[model samples]
Target: MRLTWIHPEDLIGHELRQARQDGRAVEAIARRWHDAGGHDAPPMAGASPEPAPERLRRLAEDLLDELATIPSPLADREPTGLDAVISACPDWPGAPLAAPGPDLAGRLRGAWAGRAAGCVLGKPVEKIPREGIRAIAEATGNWPIRGWFTARGLPDDVAERWPWNRRSAPTSLAENIDGTPEDDDLNFPMLALALLERYGTGFGTDDVAQMWLDELPAGRIFTAERVALRNLLVGLASPETAVYRNPFREWIGALIRADVYGWVNPGDPARAAVLAHRDAALSHTANGVYGAMFAAALAAMSLTANGPEEVLAGALRVVPPESRLAVAVREAADLARAEGDFERVLDALHARHADLHWVHSVNNAAAVAAALVHGAGDFSASVTSVVSAGWDTDSDGATVGSVAGGLLGADGIPDQWTAPLHNRVASTLTGFNGATFDTLAARTHALVQETSG
Candidate 1:
C-alpha cells in the first residue's frame, strides 16, 4: 500500500537504513531492487507497465515489517540520577541553585502566555525553507530576529520569493497581529489539562487516544498522531498504533503536547515525565516518546529551577541515560558552550542532523538546547533564536516559550511579546473556546494545588 504522506523512495530508503542500524543484512533487498531497475516505481501505467519494479518495492515494504517484528536492542547504560543521564557524561558542571518561591499562579500564567506568544511568532514561518526564513526576516529588518516579524517594507520580489505560511501569515506577522490564533500546540495543552482533570495521573494511553477521538478533529492532527488516530479507527492498540505504518514516530508531535503535564507537576520532573510518557505512548515510541518526557520534565523543573542551565539538567534527568535524544541534547548544550557563537551552533546542528528528516527529534531537540544555552534564560532571546534558527519553527518556539515562561513567570515576560497576544487564545478543544492565558493559568494552578499539595 502507498503512504499518502511519504514518497515511496523515502520509505524504501528509511527502512533500509533501519535495517542497517539493526545489523540486519539488506543484501537480498538491495540486490533485488538493483536487479529490478533501481528505486523508481515505473511511472508509466499503460500496457507493459513495469510490474517487476512494483513487485520489488512491495518486497521491500514487506521486509520492513519482518524487520520491525524482531527486537534489536542497544547496549547502553540506564539512567540513575539527574546528572549525566546518558553516557554517564557526568552531571552538568555546575552547582545547584535554590528552588524558586511558591508563586504557582504567576508561573502557570507565564507558561501559557509565553507558549501563545511564541507559537504566533513562529506560525508564519512554519514551513519556510531555512534560508528563506532568514532572507525574509533580513529583508524585513528582522535579522537576528529581535521581535515578531513584519511583512512591511519588503521588495515585491523578495516577498514573492519567500512568502509567509499562507495559513498563518495574515495574523502572525507583526503588522497584522491580533489575538492568539488556534494552534495544535496550545490545543494539546488544553486537552492534557482536560485529561488530568478527569483521570488525574492515573490516565493511560487509551485515555489520551480517546480524548483525541472525542474532542480533536481528524484534520487537526499530523504525522505520528494522524497515523495513530487512523490506527485507532481500525481497532489497533496503543503501542501498536505508534508503529503501524508510522514513519514519523520519532518526529516532534508528542513533544509539542507535553507542557501541561509538566505545568501540573511543578518541581517534580520525574513524575512529570511519567505523565508525559502515558500521553506520548498513544502515538510515539523511543526518542519520540523521550522528547515529550524531556520537555515535560524541563517545564516542571523550570517552574522552580533557578535558571535555564539548571532546568536543562533536570530535563536531561528525566529521560534514559542511554537514549539518542539525551545524547543529542547534551551534545547540543556542550556545543553551545564550546562554540559561543549562535550562528555556528545552528550550522553545526544542521550538519550533524542533516541525514534525518526535517522534523526529526534529534536535531530539533538540539536546536531547543542551543536556544536555551544561547538565550541564557532571556524570554525574547530564546524564543526568537529558536524560531529564527528554523527547523520546526512553531514547535520550537512553543517549547522554548513554555520552558522560559515557567522560569520567568507571567510578570517576568516582556510586555512586547505578551501584549500582542492580547491576553486571548483560541483552541479546538471542547469547553476551551476563546480562552485567556490568565484563565488557563488559574485553572492549572488550582489543579496543582489540589493534586500536588
Candidate 2:
C-alpha cells in the first residue's frame, strides 16, 4: 500500500511528484545529480506560488498514478539479488589486493577507535548547516576545525541560528567528552556484527530484515530504515520493505552501516562489497545500496591498501562504474586531489551538493571521498577534513576516520584523538554499550580470520 498521506509541507513529496513521472525517487539519482554540481528545479515560472493544499493533493494523485504505471528504464533496479550486483561491479583493475602485513589486530583497533573519535568530533554539529558549522567554528577559534567544538563563550545571535545537536552537546563538546556515545552510526555496525556472527557470510537480505526486527529499536531507526521497518511490520517482504513508502531508500542510512562488512572481509573487497549489498538491500537500492558497497569495499581494502588513493580505487571497482554514486565519488576524488586546502575542497563539495538533501548518500559519499583522498593517509587530516566539510558531519567523519584508522593502524593513531574517549565506545545494544575498543577489535579480528579461513 502507498504511504497514502505524506506531510503536506514535505519537499521530498514535491520532488517525488516531478520524479515519479519518470519513475524515480527524490534521492539517489537526484542526489547524484546534485553532488556532481547539478541545480534544483528552476523556480516556478510565475512569482506567485501555488496553494500548498492543492499542490499536495495534485502531487499525491500524480504519485499514485505514476506508481501504477511501469517505471522508467532509467529508474533504479528492482529486487534482482546478488547476481545483478556482482555483474554490476566494474572489473578489477589489477590483481586483487592483499591484506596488510603484521598488526592486523592493531589496525582493527584503530578503525573502531578512529570511527568513534571522528564520530564524536562531529556529533554535536551533525545536522547543523555547513555554513553554520563554519560560523560557529570560526567564532570558537575552531574553524578549519582541528578539534571537537565547545559551547563556551560564543555570541548568542550566532549560536542561536547555528545550534549544536542539543541531544548531543553534553557529551560531544570538548570538556565533557568522556566516551563515544550512542549514535546510529556506531549502532548499525554493532548490529551488523551480530548479523555476521549469527549467520556468517551466508546471511541474505531477509536475514538482515529479520535481525532488525529482533534487535534495533523503532525510535532509533530513521529515514529509510524507519520506513522499511513500518513496511515490514505491515507485511511487506524482503526487498519490498525497502521500496514501500520508503523514499528515503537512497539516504545515508545504508552507508553508515557498511563498515562491518569491510572489517570482516579485510583484503577481499569483492566479498566485502557483496556482503554489504545483501545487508544494504534490506532498506536501500541503487546508489544508496552502492554507497554501502563502496564503503565496505574501501574498508576491506584499507586493511591492505598502501594509501587512501589505492583504497579509493579499489572501492570504485566494487560499484557500477556508470552509477551516479560512482560518478559523484569520482568527482569528489578528482576535486579533492586538485584542490589543496582542506576547507576549499569542502567549499567545492558543499557548492556542488547544495541541490541535494543534506543526508543523501550520493552527496555524503562525495564528502567521504573528499576526506579520504585529500586526507592522504593522515588520521587528523582525514577526520578533520570530512567533519569540517559538513553535510551529515558525524557520518562523514566516522566513515573517513574508520578508513584512515584502518590504514594507519592502532599504534599509529595519535593519543589526542583516542585518549579523549578513554579507549571506549558506546551503543545501546545489549552487552555492547560502553564496551572498550580493545575488546571490539579483538572480536573483529577473530571474526575476520574465521571468515577468511
Candidate 3:
C-alpha cells in the first residue's frame, strides 16, 4: 500500500479554513499557533498581496489577550524536591566521590538510566489524550509504567520482537509518532550520544564548538544570538561586532543538548552547568540556558550518584532562583503535595498559560515541573507526566528521560520499554547509529572515563 503524507503547511491552512467556516476569527487561529510555539508566518517572497502590519498586529493582540486568560494549575508554587519515598530509598546512590577515578563509570551509568527512565515515562503517552493517560496509569498501578526490569532478563516473545516503525496512519503536526524528520532536529539524549561519540576526551571546548559547526549543513548558518552565546564559552573568541543577539526560546533544542558536557566533567556538576550555560548562550537566553544547565547538572551529578532528589537539588542550585523555570518547578512540587491528582495541576497550568508559545519560558517551565514532580524519582512517572502534558513532548521527554535514565542506571530500566525499542534510535544528523541502548550506555561510560582521566 502506498503511503500518503500531508504537509504541515497544508494542515495549517485546512485548520484555518475550518475555523473560519465555523465563524472563528483570525485571532483564534493566531492564539492556537502561539499555544503550539509558533510565530506569525513569514511573508512569501514575490507575493503581490501582503497582510497589512496593522491588521497582523491586531490579530496578535487578540491572540495575546486570549492567552492571558488561560490559567495553568502548577504555575504558582515554589520548587520542592521529590517525595519521601524517593528520599528514603536506602539503595539510592549518593554524590560521586571527589576527583579522577573508576567511580565515574557508576555515576555515568546512573545518569544514563535516568535518561532512559524519562523516555519510558513519556513513550506510551507521547500523543495520548490526558484522560486516556490518566486511565492507563490507573489500570497499570503505575502512573507511567515504572520499574519492571528483572536482572534475569526479558520474556521470550518480547525479547524476539524487532524494532521498527509500527504506526500505520498519517501523522498530525502535533504528533510526530515515529520521530520523523519533521520532529525537532535534535533531542537531549541523542545530542549527548553524538557529543560523546565525536568529541570524546581529547577535544577541548573550541574543538567541540568547531565540530558542532562543521556538523551543520554548509548553507545553514548559526544565528547571531548563537554566536554571541558561543563567544561566552571557554576558548571561543568574543566577537566585537555585536551582530548577534539571543534567540531565547527558539533555540531550546540546542540548549538542552549540553548533557554531554556534564557527562564529560563527571562529579563536577558546577563545572558542567557552567559549560552548559556557555554552550547554551550561543543560541538561547534566560531560562533556555537554565534548562540546559539543569539537564547538564543532573547528567553530571548522575555520573557520581543515583539519588534523584540529590541530583535534582544539584541541578536547581545551578539555575537562577528567581527565574520562571525555577518558579514553575517549585509550584508543581507544591501542587503535588496539596493535590493528589497530577492531571488537575496540568489543567490549571493549561488554563493559565496555554496561550504561551510551547518554547517560551513558561511552557518549558511547566515541562520541567511536570517531569520533576510526576516522575518523583520514579523514572516512568517523570517521563509520562511531562510527555503526556503535551507541548514539546519529544524534547521534554528526551531530556527528562535521559536524566532519569542516568540516575536509575541501565539495569534499573524496565525490560518492556527497552525490549520494544531494541535500543534503536535514529537521527538524520551524522555521527549517530541505530544501536541498542546498552551499547550506547557502555560507550557513554567509556567516554566519561577517557575525559575524566
Candidate 4:
C-alpha cells in the first residue's frame, strides 16, 4: 500500500511542478522522470496509489536532491529569510504596541468561535471544486451557504456527483456536528497556543519542532508537515526538514497555523509576522513562509483596524512586494474591489490562478484576500465566500473567520453562525480535545497581556 505523502516517487513528481513554478531549469529532470516511466502526482488530497518499484524510488531520491540545488530564478525577489523578506518590502511597518479594543475578551471569543464555525462549515466540502459546491448547495436549497452544510436534503444525483469529504461528512455536516470537529486547520492553532504557553513569545523553530513531536500525532499531519516530520524522525533539523524532499513546501499548511501568533500579538503585525515566520520555517519556504506572515499580520490588524480594507493593507506590508504570494493577494484584492458580484470576482480569480495548485499558498491566499475584501466585514459573507472559492476550503474559511471574528467581536457575528459551534472545539492534539472556545480565548487573552506587559 502507498503512504500518501512520503513516498519518494510521489514526492519527486510534485517537486518537479514546484521547480517549474519557481523558474528552475528542470527540463532535463522532467525528461529523466518521464523516460523512467514515473508519473506526475495527483492533484487531490490524501491520494494513495500503489508504490513504484525500488529502483524508481531510488532514482526519485537522486532527482529530488538535484532539483533542490538548482536555485529558483525568482529567488532574489522571494527571499526566505525574515530579514531579507522585510528588506524587500519597502512599506515594512515596524511592530505596533498592543492596542486591543475595549471588548478584547469578547473579540477573542468571537475569533476562536468563528474559526471553528467556518472550519466546520467548509469541512464537508473540503476537496469539492467550486462548481461542485454550487451544485451541491443549490440542490439542497443552500446556494449562498449562510449556514452549516447538510447532507440531509442533498439530492441523490448531486451527492454522487460531488460526494462529501469522507472523514468530514461523519462529524461536520449540519445534522452531525456536536461541536467543532477535528481538522488540521484547528489543530495547528491549538499547537500554537501550547507553544506560547510553554516557551513564551520567544519560541524558536526548534521549539515548534519539539512541540509537534510531543503533542501532534504523526498520522494527523499531512503534506509539507508530514514530510517535515519524516525528516525530523531521521534526525534532521528544521530549515533542512522543510526543504529536504518536501515538494509541498509552498502549500497551505503553514498558513493554517498562523492565527494564534496574531492573536498573541494583537495590533502588532510585524511582531506577529516574525513569530509566524519562525514557526513556518519548520515546514515551508518563500511563498509558504510569506503566507503564514500574511495570515498572522491579517489577524493582528483585525484586532484594531476599522475595516477589511485597512486590515488587508496593513497585512500586506509584511510580505515582500515582488513575491508571487504578494502579487496574487494584491491582484485578488483589486479584483474584489472592482467587481461587485462575488461570482464574477471568483471567475476572474480562478482564471488568473489556473496554473497554481488548488492548495498552493498563492491561490488560496488570493482566495482568502478576495473573500475578506469582498465580504466587507460581514462574518458570514467572508467565511462563505472563501469557502466557496473551493481551494483548501476549511483552511481559508478558518482564516477568514478568525479575521472577521476579531474585527466584528462576538456579539457582531450572527447567532446562526456561532450557535452551532456549541462553544467547544475538538482536536487530536493533547489537552485540546473537547476544549471550549471560551477557555481557549481566555488563555489567548492572557498571553496578549503577558506579551504586552
Q: Highest lDDT among the candidates is held by which one?
A: 4
TM-score of 1: 0.87
Model 4 residue 435 CA deviation (Å) reads 1.0
Output the lDDT of residue 90, model 2: 44
Please tell me which model should have the higher lDDT, number 2 or number 4. Answer: 4
Error of 2 at 136 (Å): 0.9
Predicted structure 1: lDDT: 0.78
- The digit string of per-residue lDDT tens for model 2 on 371-390 reads 89888899998898888777
- Candidate 4, superposed: residue stretches over 4 Å from native: 46-48
lDDT of all predictions: 0.78, 0.78, 0.49, 0.90
Show where candidate 2 strays beyond 4 Å: 1-65, 68-70, 76-81, 92-96
Question: lDDT at 367 for candidate 4?
Answer: 95
Task: Write model 1 residue lDDT over 215-327, tens digit each, in one string.
Answer: 99877777778878888999999889887766667778999999988888888777787788888888877778888888898888888987899889888876775677888
Scored against the true structure, residue 350 in model 1 reaches a CA lDDT of: 83
Residues forming the 10-long window of minimal summed lDDT in candidate 1: 41-50
- Preferred candidate (TM-score higher): 2 or 3: 2
What TM-score do all the candidates reach, one by one? Answer: 0.87, 0.87, 0.60, 0.98
Best by TM-score: 4
Report how far off residue 198 is in candidate 1 (Å). 1.5
Return whichever of 1 and 3 wins on TM-score: 1
- lDDT, candidate 3, residue 276? 68
Distance from true position, residue 431, model 2, in Å? 1.7
